[model samples]
Target: MNLLKIENIQYSYGKNTPFEKEVLKNISLEVNANDFIGVIGHTGSGKSTLIKICNGLLKPDKGQIFYKGENIWKKGFDLKHLRFKVGVSFQYPEHQLFCETVKKDIAYGLVNKGVPEEEQESKIRQVLKIVGLQESYLEKSPFKLSGGEMRKVALAGTMVLEPEVLILDEPTAGLDPKTTKQVYESLKEYQAKTSSSIIVVSHSMEDISEYATRLIALDDGNILLRGTPAQVFSNTERLNDMSLDVPITTSILSMLAQKNPSVNTNIYRYNDTKAEIIRLLKDVKSIE
Candidate 1:
């Protein structure tokens, strides 16, 4: 199920001036249901700008964006309704928090969409749990929560909309390792439960490679590459050529596997790599 499609999209900034710059150029991609899309690139790659266009926050100067096979920018399209369906959690979601309490902030979008008050509380609680925020924090001021908690609360607000597609930009930035792991695992579990498609914009392959079904690489306003994490990571030289680095583990294993085939590390994921190593060691010992 292709949930969203972007075709020949182009965006320009600072129009009507000699300083005009075009960020995206002839970009086309298909985003499917239940797909975890990881977008990676160096800074200024137009990744954020592209996603903004997807959610209707920005209209591209050229090309079309489709939702469920229909041109989303067509006349009579309800962009507000589309936004609710494809929830976008920006790079620093907490910065958008303005309500008095975490509960109100999370419920803000739902309320704006006219969901009943009774359903609002239920939805808020459900999404808060989905983002791993305790019930106690619901009443607290979002301004006072820790960085990680604030990020989760921000995500909770977005999930309350029950969107079919979620576009999260650098959701795990500036968090402690434990909280980052928790946020990642929480979203993974939520995706498993709901089977919702998620598109994450991030520079760190290490953050999402283990789970993202596809990775899209962008650089200097162009889509440099797109494929499964393993497939994309295989082109280490290309990644470097674009000023991006593969996951540290992938680079380490890739170098070692070439020099020492006995390493037998054929996996790009952590658990799979560990298990493969263990199985190989047991086989080696058995032969001895």
Candidate 2:
């Protein structure tokens, strides 16, 4: 069964007002098992609104959101349970942090669900490690940590539940390059182990292209393109027209192809780009 599905969803910011503005129009999406979906769009493209609707945090003006074939908005559908199953961490998760310590913050959800104290402690430690934090830091105030550290804590809080579908919005917004990579690696590893689906909204073409199995590009509240990273990035002209740039690796490969006919310009991943370059170097050595 599809993990989550959005069917012809429409949303507006205001109703019957002069300032009313529609943010989404007939948006449809299907998330399957073990799917890693990347959503990209400029400001006001409704990416945030769409994700919020997926977890029952926001109601759509039209259409329905389904989790495991059940309409999320249907009466007595257990919205609380749906939220627990489909975890969502917003762009600035630190805003939601209110506990005195990181451990308490991460344990809040467990407490609500009435999980055993011992299991909560174990899950807290496990998720902390996944987020690359030391156990010693658990007692420290989340408010005292750096921006990147706080973000990690927030991520751990959501991940501790081991939700079937994880949604993150700019999860790496405040992190350095190394930290960003570590966060993505942790998420990738978590998904691999649990077969859970992930939906990430990011502006970084490089990171998204490398990690996401599929890509969705939104423009003016509508889906402009959707496909594998290579397939979507292949439409350089269309993306450029939409003010979106392809991954740096893809652009570099395209440049290499222009100079060398044998170069494969379809590469969108950094590792693949490096491998292609190494193969070319070996070919040159053999020729010489």
Candidate 3:
């Protein structure tokens, strides 16, 4: 089932001023359970605006959003419940932390939602373990932790809510390679175990290739394309024209396929392209 749905969403910023801008124009999309969707686009493509609307942080000027098949704007709908159902981890989420200790920070959200004190403590322990943060850190100041540790603590804060749909905005931005790999892999593993739907908003082509099941491409506030990473990154010309870079991994395979058209390079993903190259070489050797 679709965990989140957007229909003909239209939104404008600074609406009555001379500088008014239309950010999202009739955009429509859906996120199903267990889907890791990577969203990318040019600078002004409205990527951030779209997500804010998706999570109900900002109401749309027009159109409707449904969560789990129920209209969110319907009479007396549970806004809080819906938010808990779809948790959003903002960019620089760590800075939002204000608690004296890591345990308090991670448990902040769960506690505010009125979960029993005992239940909240147990849930915090479970999520802290899930994110691989030690219980020892629970008593330490969040500001004193390493950058990666801080990111994990922030993520754990959100995860403790146990939302079915998780949205992360630029999760790996500004991290060292090793840190990025570890955090991303942790997220991937968590999804594998929980089958939670995740939407990642990032402009990094390589990250998209590594994490996204499907990639959504946007330009000038409109969706240019939506498909698997292999499919979206396969169109070299189109991506270039849109001023977006194809993943280096995809570019390598694309070059190989073009050098010998026998292996159609339209296959954009890394593993599939590798298999295709091996298959083509085997056939060529056999003929020789």
**What Cα-based lDDT does every candidate model obtain?**
0.86, 0.92, 0.85
Name the runs in model 3 displaced over 4 angstroms. 263-288
TM-score for each predicted model, relative to the true structure: 0.95, 0.96, 0.91
* lDDT by residue (tens digit), candidate 3, 1-288: 798999988899998999999999888899998899999888888888988888888888999999988888889988888888889999988889899999999989888788888898888888777778788989999999988889989999988888888889888778888878777787777787788989998878887788899888878777888899878877778888788988876677667766776766565555776787789789889999
- Predicted structure 1: clash tally: 0
Candidate 2 residue spans exceeding 4 A from truth = none
lDDT of 1 by residue, 230-275 (tens): 8888888899999988787776676767865776444578777777
- 37-111: candidate 2 lDDT, tens digit per residue: 999988888899998999998899999899999999989899998888999999989889999999999999988
| lDDT, residue 186, model 2 | 86
Q: Pick the candidate with the highest TM-score.
A: 2
Q: For each predicted model, how many residue pairs clash, with residues at least 3 apart or on different chains?
A: 0, 0, 0
Ranking by TM-score: 2, 1, 3
TM-score, predicted candidate 3 vs. hidden true structure: 0.91
Instruction: Please give the distance, in angstroms, between residue 66's alpha carbon in candidate 1 and its true position after superposition.
Output: 0.6
